[model samples]
Target chain A: MNDKVRNSLFYVGGTAVGFVSGFFGGGGGMLCVPLLQFGGLDAKRAHASALLVILPICIISAAIYIKNGYFDVTAVLCACIGVVLGGIVGATALDKLNGTAVSIIFALLMIAIGIKSVIA
Target chain B: MTPQHVIIIVSALGGVIGGMGMGGGTLLIPLLTLAAGLEQHLAQAINLIAFVPMSVVALVIHKNNGYVSIAKSAPIVGCAAIGAVCGSFLARYAGGYELRASFGAFLIALGLIQMYKAISAVVKKKKASKNKSAQIKVG
Candidate 1:
C-alpha cells in the first residue's frame, strides 16, 4: 500500500490498540509491538517503540483513574517500588530464560487467571 | 508477611514478568485482586501508575541502543490519545464486576493467541533443526 493509505490505516490501528490498553489499564504495548512490526519495524525495535506509544496511553488512563478518585497513595507507591525493582531483574534475566518456555508458561498463567477471573 | 509485603512481592513478580517484555500489568491486576485483596479499579490504577517509571527506564536503555523510532509515530500517538480518553471513560463508567469479567475474557483471548504463537515457534525450531541434521548427515 501507499504511504498515505498505510499511515492512515496504522493511525486507526493505533487508536484501537490504545483503546484496549486504556480500557484494560495495561497490555496495550503487547499489541502495539506487533502493529509496529507490521508498520515496518524489526522485532527489537518494535518492542522498544511500543513502550514509547504505551507510555502516553498509560499516563492518560492513570490520570482519568486518579481524577475519578481511584487514587491510592500507599498502594501505588508500594507497587511502583516493587515493579521497578522486579523490572530490573526481569530485564537482566531475559537473556538467560529460554524464550519458548517462558512464553508458554506466561500464556498458560494468563489463561488460568482469566478463567478464575470469569468464575470468581 | 503483612498484606503490604504481599503487595510488594506480588507486584515485583508481575514487574519481573513485565520487564522481560511480556505484559506484566495484565498478570499484576489479577494478582492484586486475588492475592493482594485489592479492588479491581484500585488495582488497575496502581498498575497504570507503576508502568510509567518502569517504562521510562526501559525506554532510555532501548533508545540508547537505537531501538526506538519515535520519529514517525506522531500521528499514531495523537490518535491513540483520543482513543485512550474514550477508553478511560468507558472503564470509569463500567462497574468493577463488569470490568473484571471483561478483563478475564480479554486475558483468555491474549493467552490463547500467545500459546499458539509460542507452539508454532517451537515447531518451527524443531523443523529447522531436523533439516540441519539431515543436511549434516548427507554431507
Candidate 2:
C-alpha cells in the first residue's frame, strides 16, 4: 500500500482496536503488533510503536478506572513497575532474537489461551 | 482495495467490536495477517499501540462504574507488561512469517476453546434445569 493509504488505514484500524481493548481487557498491544506489521513496520519498530501508543491509552484508562473505583493503586503501581522493568528487558532482547520464531510461539500461545477460554 | 482503505476499515471495525465488549486482538490480528498481509509480529505490535487509547477509555469507564478491582488488575497488568516485553524481544529474532503463522494458530485455538466453554456452560445449565424439573414432577 502507498504511504497515504497505509497511514489512513493505520489510524482507522487503530481506533477500532483501541475500542476493543478497552472493552475486553486483552491489552491493546496484541492488536497493534499485527496491524503495524501489515502496515510495513518491522517487528521491532512495531513493538516500539505499540508500547509508545499504549502509554496514553493505558494511563487514560487507569485514571478513569481509578475515578470510578475500579483501580487499585497498589496493583497499578506494582504492575507498572514490573512492566517498566520487563519492557526494558524486552527492548534489549528485541535486538537479539528471531522475530518469526517469536511470532509463532506467541500465536500458538494465543490459540491455546483462546481455546481454553472458549472451552472452560 | 489499498492498504489505506484496509487500515481505515479495520480500525473502525475494531472500534465497534471493542465497544461491544469483544477483544480487538481477536479481530485485528486476523485481518492484519490475512488482508493487510502483515507479519504477525508487526500486526501484533500495531494492535498493541492502537489498543492503548481505547483501553484507557474503557478502563476509565469501568473505574467510574466501580468495576476495576484494582487488586486483581494489578497482577494481571504487571504480568502482561512483563510478558509483552518478552514477546517484543522475541519478535526481533523470529521470522515474521513464522510469528504470524504461530500466533494465528494460537488465536484460533484459543477462540475455539472459549467458544466450547461457553457452549458447555449453556448446555450444563439446561441439563441442570431439566433434572430439577424431573425431580419436581416425581415429587
Q: How close is candidate 2 to the true structure, as a TM-score?
A: 0.52
User: Which 10 residues in a row give candidate 2 chain A its minimum summed lDDT?
Assistant: A75-84
User: In order, how many clashes per candidate?
Assistant: 0, 69
Cα lDDT tens digits, model 1, A1-120, are: 898898888998999878987777877777788889889899889988888898998999999989988888888888988998898899899999999999999999999999998898
| Model 2 stretches with alpha carbons more than 4 Å out | A1-120, B75-79
Error of 1 at A12 (Å): 1.4
| Candidate 1 segments whose C-alpha is farther than 4 A from its true place | A1-5
Chain A TM-score of prediction number 1: 0.91
For residues A1-120, write the lDDT of model 2, one tens digit per residue.
688886666666666445434333234665665666776666545544454445554444433333433333332333233333333344346557664444444445446544433343
Stretch of 10 with least lDDT, candidate 2 chain B: B71-80
Return the top candidate by DockQ: 1
Q: TM-score, each model?
A: 0.95, 0.52
